[model samples]
Every structure is written in C-alpha cells, then in structure tokens.
Target chain A: MKENYDIVIIGGGPAGLAAAVSAYDNGAKNILILEREPRLGGILNQCIHNGFGLTRFKESLSGPEYAYRFIKEVEARDIDVLLNTTVLSLEDNKTITAINSEYGVFSITPKAVILSMGCRERSRGALNIPGSRPAGIYSAGTAQKYVNIKGYLPGKRVVILGSGDIGLIMARRMTLEGAKVLAVCEIMPYSSGLRRNIEQCLNDFNIPLYLNHTITKIEGTSRVTGVVVSKVDENKQPIEGTEMHFDCDTVLFSVGLIPENELTKGAGIEQSRNTRGAVVYQNRETMIDGIFACGNVLQVHDLVDFVSEESEIAGACAANYVLNGRQEHNPISCINGDNISYVLPQKIDKNIPGNVKLFFRVRNTFKHCKIVVESNGVVLQEKKKLICVPGEMETVILSSDVIAKAEGDIVVRLEC
Target chain B: MNKQLTCIECPMGCLIEVEVENGAVKSVKGNTCLRGKMYAENEVICPLRVVTSTVKTVSGKMVSVKTDKPVRKSEIFEVMKKINSLTLDRNVVIGDVILANIDRDANLVATQNYND
Candidate 1:
C-alpha cells in the first residue's frame, strides 16, 4: 500500500466519494478514500426510498442508485478506496492513524486531508424520555436499517416520535410492511421534515401527525407497550393534563442528527457552537493549513446534492493546497444574526476570487422574509423568501469583491 | 368535482386545485408552472408512484429494488405484496430486472448490487 498520497478523504460515503472523484478530476492523482464501513456506499445502502439526486442527476433516484453513480465514477477513474478501514486519530499535522483487519494499525500522512464523516441520528438517551429501558425502542435510522437491509420487522405496532424525513418515511415503510403506525408526534410546532414527505408519507397513509407534542412517558416493562403523548406549551414544557396514552408495541425516535466530529475534536480543530462541526473558510479549509472539511462533518445537510457540492469545494481546495503551496490571505468571520441559526464556511478567504455560497438554516419557521447579508455596516445583498423553516436549508451567494471589501464581520439575518 | 392536491413535480410543492368533469380534468388552478398543472391533472386522473422495497436474495441478504416506471397508486399495496413475496436466487447488480411486467408499465429493478 502507498505510504503517502496527495489527498486522503475520510469516510467513503457520498461526500467522501464525490470529494475523491472531484480531487482526481482537478489534477490530484494520488488520492485515496478510507471508509469505515465494509461497503463503499455508506448509509445510502439502507435508504431504499427514492426522491434523491433531483438536482445532481436531474432524475429521481434511490439512495443506493445515487451513491452507486458516484461509486461507479470513482471506479472508472481507478481511484483507490480502502473499505472496512476505521480511522482512529487525526493529528493536527495531517497524520491519520487507521486500523483494519487485513492491515494492522498503520499511520499515513497525506499532503492534505478532507473530513467527510457524516452525522448520526440522535438516540433515545439524548431525548431522556421517561421510560423503562426495554426492547422495541429504536432510532428511526436503526429501524430503517433493520427493515430495509436486514429484512426484519422491529414491531407490529409502531409509534414514531419526531416528524423528520426518516420518521415520516418509516411511517410509510412500516405501514407497507404490515405494521399499524399509531401516530407521529413532533415536539416542535412545525415538522422538521420536507413538506413533500409529510404529504406523501404520513398524509397519504392516513397517519395522524401531532405537532407541538411529545411523549410524556413510555409505558412498558419488558418491551414497549404504549407511550403517553402530551402537548407542550410555548416554553416546550409539557402541559400536565394533556397527556393521552396510546397502546403501541414499538417506539421509533427521529429526533435529530449530530455530526460525527470526534476525530476533529481529537485533532483540536476549531468548531462552531451552532453547527457542532469544524469552523472553515470559504474554500472549506479549516484554520489548520492542510486540513479541510465538508459535507455533514462540517454541518448536517438536508440533501446529498449539497454535500456533493460542498465536498467538491473541499476536494478542489485540498488538491490546490497540495499542488500549489498554501497562500496567505486576509480572512473575515461570517456571523449568523437575527433568525439565522448558523452559516457554513464560517470564514471567507478574501484571496479566493469568486462568489462564495453561504448556506444557512433559520432558528424557527417564518413566512415571507428577506435574507440580508451585511458586512462592514453595508448591506451587500438581500433575497426574498416566501417561507423558511429550520428543516429546509437555504443558501445565498456573495461575490468575492463584497467579501474582500468587508472590514467587519459578515452577517446574515432574516428580516420578516 | 373539485380536488385538492400538492404538486410533487419539484420542491415547490404547489397546492393545486383541480376541477374534474365527466372523468376529465377541466382545469388546474394555483399551480405556478405547467409541470404542476400536468401533475395535478394526472393526480386527479390517475395517481402514480414508484414503489421501492427490498427482496430477499439467495444468500438471505435483502437487496433494495424499485419500479423502473411509476405504478398506479391504487395498485401500490398489490404491487408491494408481489414485491414482498419475491425472492431472488442469484447475485444481481444495479439495474438488474428482478421482476418483469410488475403492475402497469413497471419493472422491478435492483437499485444496489447484491454480491452475496
């Protein structure tokens, strides 16, 4: 095996696969992808439902299909892929300590590194729902894997908590598999899933969606027997008398996803408190000279297309860092203001002479609002949006000239 | 008759109202694009969706598959039954036809390779 490479992309999911392909296409030949999973497709292998790749492929494809396209592209270019390789530690100096069954513990120092380790679903422990720790309670993603990949039904009666895409999709999936989906309870006033999913998954199947509600208690001893649902007030505190019990056998939690950044944390990379991922510049390069990050590792993205797009930038930037030496540039911090929760590429390198797309999510739902970007007390750009939700990600592009001329922090705010 | 539907043509998901007369779409309103109008009309006439599910392989591993074309919405459960009952006895790659002529104008095709 090669001891050194121009670029090493961690996590062979859609993000890493796309990054490797993009890096190879842009003159980085000696690139390798390290995937912890036995398969190269990552979580896409378990996502059997369609409605992916509409932006990148122009056709609705299943998750596996979308991932296979990139896998095929990587294979065609003869890009090196190491599967079942778990990366243990990532050093600040671009050294990756990895281990595999075939090859024992080994250290590889690439010229540059791209972190694409995607996010994981929030588990029951995080929710802290009052309950007897028992069987039949699974994360929506874990249940998805059991049903879609392992061909096993988790339970006959299911109660899904959270109206996110996976929970909604599983509501339909469990129904198709002959399970009675009692209800989908969301803690928020608005669903954290796409409207299309709500329409197609829950609405089409006649499953009731309870908004501004949460599970008050789990009533079961050996397994999940039922759950008590209750409405929450403005402060997210459960209304005492609103508790309603529903008898169910299974409980699926679809709360949220957290970016897997243990390696980044280990490397002592600067992280965003909002995104829970690495803080990076417009080029997706972290504060560290040769290290970069993209995809869900930087911030959890709604669509794989956006992940591919972001990783492409990271891949290109890493390749440039290896081929051409690192360039010194004046950088400005990007600040999230008002209703805006967080913005990606938290910093903009003024030296990069191109438009930088700032992707962000609102803290709450709003209708008919304008996204305003300001820098140096000057309004650089503003765009109107009819509706905005935390579930759906939004993007605005800023010209390099605007970033370069900025003397203060770049601020993105929503004016309703 | 008046029918309300959401246009799934794109992410906009316009709320479309369709007026149906004599089993035909008379008009579609509140749709922002022609695709939405067409979608409303088709949804009023006959809703269709691509069915995705997994079939057991010879090695006992489940392989994900989907219809090559849209299946009539009314027959989704029926098609799903057919899909659930099916079991492939050989290795298959993506795009391999698992079942031919599944429902109206549809073929069950593998979305991922099952080497095992």
Candidate 2:
C-alpha cells in the first residue's frame, strides 16, 4: 500500500467502484478504494433479485450483474482496491486511518477523499417495538443475506414489519423458497417501497399488506411464536380494539435506512438534517476542501443507476480538485419549500458552468400537482405531474442562466 | 373483462386499466408512457416474468443466476425447481448458460462469476 495517493475512496460498493473508475478516467491515475468486505461488490453480492440498472444499462439486471459491470470497468482501468480493509478515521486534512491484516494501523494522506459508505437498515433497537428479544427476528437485508448468500432459510413462517422494498422483495423470496409468509404490516398508510415491488413481489404472490398497522406486541421466548398487529390512527398512534394476531415463527423488520455517517461526523464536516449525510455542492464537493461524498452517504437513492451517476460527479470533481485546485465561487443555498421533504446538493455554486440537477422527495402523495422551482419570488421552472409520491424521488434541472439571475436562496415546492 | 394492473416498466408505477375481449387486449388506459401501455397489454393477455435465484456451486457456495428472458409467469416455480436441483461443477463467468432451455425459450444464465 502507498503512503500517499491522489484520491482515496472509502467503501468499495457500486458508489466507490464507479467513483474510482471516473477518477481514473478523468486523469487522476493514483487512486485507491478501501472495502471492508472480502470482495469488491458490497451489499450487491447478497442482493440476488433483479430490477437493477434499468436507467443506466437499459436492461433489468440482478444486483451482482449490475455491480459486475462497474467492477469490470474499475478492473479495466487498473484501479487499486484494498479488500477486507476497514477505515478507522477520516480527518479534515484528507488523512485516512485504516486497518487490515496486510497493513496493520496505517495512514494514507491523499490529495482528495471521496466517501461512498452506503446506508444501513434500521434495526429493531431503533424501532423500540414492545417485544421480547427473540432469535427469529432479523432485518430484511439480514434475511436476504441468509437466504441468498448463506443458503439458509431464516424461518418457516414469516411476518414482515414495514413495507420497505427489502421487506416486500423478501415476501416473495421466502414464499418461493417454500416458506409461508403470513403478512407484511406497515404503520404508515402508504408504503415507502416502490409501487413496482408491491405489484411483483407482494401482489403477485397474494401476500397480505396491512397498511396503517404495526406490531403492538411480540409474543415469543427463545424463538418467535406470534405477533399482535394493531391499526394506527391518522397520527400514526395505535388505536384500541384493532389488534390482529398472526401465528408465525419469524418477524422481519424493513422500516427504513439511515446513512452511515459516523466517519463524516468524526471529520467535523457540515451535515444536512434532511439527507442525514454531508452537505455538498453541485460538484459533490463537501464543506471541507478536496473532500467529496456521494451515493447513499450523500443521499439514499432509490435506484443504483442514480447512485452511479452521482458518484461519477463526485469522482470527476475530486479529480478536478486534485489537478486544477479549488475554484472560487459564491455558494447558494437550496431549501425545501412546502410539501418538499428534502433537496440535494444542499448548496450550489452560482458560477458553475452548465445546468445543475436538484433531486428531491415529496413529503406526501399529491395528485395533479405542479413542481415549481423559484428564487426570490421569480419562477425559474415549473412542470406538471400527474402524481407525486414519497416513494419515488423527483429531479429538476436549473440552467446556469436562471441560476445567475437568482436573488436569494432557491426553493423547491409542490403547488396544488 | 376489465382488469387493473400497475405498470412495472419504471418507478412511476402508473395504474393501467386494460379491457380484454375474446382473449385480446381491446384497449389500455391510464398509462403515462408507451412502455406502460405495452406492459398492460402483455399482462392482460399473457403475464411473463424474469426469474432470478441463486444456485449452489461445487464448493457449496451460492452463485446468482437469472433467466435470460421473461418466461410464462405460471412456469416460474417449475423453472426454480430446475435451478434448485442443479449445481455447477466448473468455473463460470457472467452470461454463461447454466441451464439451456430451462423454459420454452429462456436460458438460465449465471449473473455472477463463480470459480470453484
């Protein structure tokens, strides 16, 4: 391992692999990718289901296949990858401390650093569901790894909690593997997962989806035996006299994902409350100079195609920072308006060349609405949409001319 | 017969209603794009799905594989049975055919490279 490099990307998942390839292609030859896993592909190795790379490859590919495409690109470029290495700390001075069996307690000072560490599943401890800590409970992704990677079934009868995409997919997977999936309960009225998953994974298998419901109590000892699901009111509080019991041996939690930002926090970098990640500019450069973040570490993207695209921006910009140095520009804040959950690239460089794409999500479902991008009471762009749901993300582009004409902060909102 | 279906072609998930008469799609409505319309028509007439699963290798490691093309939805379990019972004894790369003609016209190919 080299003591110095041009760029060091943490986390060798789809984001890290794409970033390394892009950085190499953009003339940053000396780059290294640090991966904690034994292999290059991160979570993609266990994601055996298809429906990936639709936008990027224009073909429905399984997770491993999608990852292999980028992995091959990185290999062709001869990028350096450190497997089974975990980064311990990231300092603001572009210094990374990592450890592995090959290199014990080493530090590398790269000219630029890119953080591609993805998100993690919300665990049972985070949910605080009143239940006994049983052996049959597992996160949806853990169950996926168990069945797809280890070739072991988690349980015979399963009741999945929270209708996230992983849970919905596992509903079909367990059923196909000959296990009986009892029910999928979601406390929210609307499922956070993609509508396509609900169709293919749950609807096709005739799995029951209980919306506005949550597990009120878990009844089990050494192993899971049953669960009491209760309906929630408009405020998401469980109501009385609406408990439904299901006899099952396992319970899978797929509530939500939180960006793994412990290293980001340790670096004292500015964080965004909306994305739970680092605050970055249009080029994905973070508040700290020469440091960048992309993929799930910047924002939890719905599709891997978008993750690759965003990581490319981060990679190219990191290369630019290494080669040409940081350019001087005024920063413009992008804020979420009414009904807008969050907008990314929280800050945009006013003097940036070309257009900037702002990705965002809606707070709730809206029909026949107009998405308006405005600055200082002047409408920059407006588009009509048939429907907008929180499940799917939305993107809008802002031309350089409109950005130059901005008088104050840019705001994105949904107007009915 | 009028049937309701959700277009899985994209993330939009437009709800499409299809009218079928005499085993043919009479009309498709509520799709926002051409792909959605085609999906609705094909779904109402004959539903098809691409099956993906993992097969055991000679070393007892799991290697991901998938159908090369969409097959009859009703034959998914049959295709899975064929995939489950087979194990690869030789090393394989992506796109290598693990089971030829697993279905009528679809081939089960390795989605990931496995060396055993």
- lDDT (tens digit, per residue) of candidate 1 on B1-116: 99988776656568899999999999889999777787788888898778899998778899999999888889989998999898899888999999999996699999988886
Residue-by-residue lDDT tens digits, candidate 1, A14-98: 8898888888888899988999988898888889999889888888889999999999999999578889899999999889999
lDDT of each: 0.90, 0.92
Give per-residue CA lDDT, model 2, range A198-271, as digits (tens). Answer: 99999888899999999988889899999999999999899999999999999999999999999999999999
Q: What TM-score do all the candidates reach, one by one?
A: 0.98, 0.98
Judging by lDDT against the true structure, name the best candidate. 2
Q: RMSDs, each prediction?
A: 1.3, 1.3
Clashing pairs in 1: none
- Among these predictions, the greatest DockQ belongs to 2
- Runs in model 1 deviating more than 4 A are B32-34
